[model samples]
Target chain A: MEEGKGEVKHMLLAKFKEEVSEQQIEDCIKQYANLVNLIPSMKSFRWGRDVSQENLHQGITHVFESTFESTQGVAEYLSHPDHEAYGNILRPLLEKAITVDYHPTPVQL
Target chain B: MEEGKGEVKHMLLAKFKEEVSEQQIEDCIKQYANLVNLIPSMKSFRWGRDVSQENLHQGITHVFESTFESTQGVAEYLSHPDHEAYGNILRPLLEKAITVDYHPTPVQL
Candidate 1:
């Protein structure tokens, strides 16, 4: 694929602190999802709570996956003022957070 | 959504041992991706390397995402012989692995 042309999946794995309430996490997720609307490059957003039977989550309870048309779109979303604002609301409640971005490659075999 | 009717994304985050060769990891990923073809419930497979500028990954180097039609489909995949076989090939090369599954919910806001 051409540079910055492939689809990128931005994955955020978060584990809320024990003291954080469910309502706060819910509110944080809602705002995080709204970034899709606030930033044009953020094409779509979806999220989920951990549901695996496998004891391999390493305490990460929430997974937020967002799609961008290209890496540039992700960079734009990352630096956008709205994301910064959302982070301010989210940072205090998190026990840990991990973010990964990639240009998804399809496997035919 | 009705029980087992929504889509489920199974995300695997892996960090290979320092001693593992690059080719070994590549082979492992290719085998993992091919599980889509081996297991009927595994609807699609895609993967990517960490490209995030942020240092939040906590050692996760690769992300493998597989989509299933429903939770039941994922349960079926978990017990499939092919996945078990793939696991045998993958587990030994990894220093750490985290797997999480979720039925992705769209954010309306």
Candidate 2:
């Protein structure tokens, strides 16, 4: 593992309260879609809500996938006010979650 | 398209500068491993740097995999000072990156 170098992925998962309104849900979905799609290094993106009666994917509010060139790449994305605004909007119902950051060590070199 | 609910995955890709040293590398890897592994709902985890000779994963510092029950679930993870401290240590060499939040909408009710 080199000292100041390596690839890293930030993975996050979140939940919301049960009494959320429909209008707020619509707004969040629309806004989040546009935001994730607009990033330059976002290789791909996906999102949706948990609606399983059996609760197979229970309690999950959203799932996203996007890749950046470097840790700085993620910083740039997080710095956008647009992103912050959405976080503010969704801040109310957020429940339990996790975010892990890591990078691989050089194998052959 | 539900209004205020869905499963979301926060994914991030990062890059760092090329001048990193070895001790810092040890510090980050050990700490990050413990953090990610300790989360309660953490289903799975992965991390690594971009070291492919063919440059397949170029510029990527880390890649992590984890699932949360809700947006709120993620909040708990981010609020911890331990996580934040690592970010502080890692703040210097971080280069470029992107973080996408998403969820799988419940289909069958």
Candidate 3:
């Protein structure tokens, strides 16, 4: 975790289209993981398919979490060509999507 | 960033009650953060308030992300006494809440 550098998190929660297979979702996630390696402004990226049967998710079935150096980093990631390409591939498969971004302050217990 | 240990992510996104002040929300987030330091199974925890005016979020105001060693680690964190206490404080303040948990797989683009 990088401290005091205006760290921000970008998160996505989505449900896949009924026709989208599990393997396709895995492929899409891998594509996103690869973007982290290529994007210097992205501090960290992790994604996963929902494995829980819990009611708390309200139908959300997958999640992607990424930490960027700052809001600017977030903008750069959003506009990056690779991200655009990935989004094109992902959009059709997403039945529903929600995104949230925030600046993370250190939590001192 | 632990590898090959059945890493799982737990995420929460919520909107606060109409009367809940921003400071109260921040305080609640800090309490949750402190639990990370106390819980042996919680590998990492980070949180922030939604800074975007983007329509994508659909009213969700905050997010919390935590990584655990495995599903068991997640169960342990959920059942911890500190978590229960914190939830009691949080539940009343939340107008809406959504949680998602998943086992993260490495994305090999």
Query: TM-scores of the first chain across all predictions?
Result: 0.91, 0.60, 0.85
Candidate 2 has a TM-score of 0.41
TM-score of 3: 0.82
Evaluated with DockQ, which candidate comes out highest?
Answer: 1
Candidate 3 residue spans exceeding 4 A from truth:
A1-5, A37-40, B1-5, B37-39
Tell me the tens digit of each residue's lDDT in model 3 across B1-109.
3233487878888999989987787777777888877889988787777865347898998778787878888888888888888889999999989999877555544
Q: For residues B14-46, could you state the per-residue lDDT of candidate 1 as single tens digits? A: 898999987787777778877877899999987
Q: What fraction of the reference interface contacts is present in each model, in order?
A: 0.77, 0.22, 0.69
Q: lDDT per residue, candidate 3, A4-104, as tens digits?
A: 34878788889999999878977777777888888888877777767653479988888887878788888898888888888899999999999998775
Clashes of each: 0, 72, 0
**In model 1, which runs have C-alpha deviations exceeding 4 angstroms?**
A1-5, B1-5
Report how far off residue B37 is in candidate 3 (Å).
Answer: 5.5
Interface RMSD, every prediction, one decimal place:
3.1, 12.2, 4.3
Candidate 1 chain B weakest lDDT stretch, 10 residues:
B1-10
DockQ of 1: 0.61
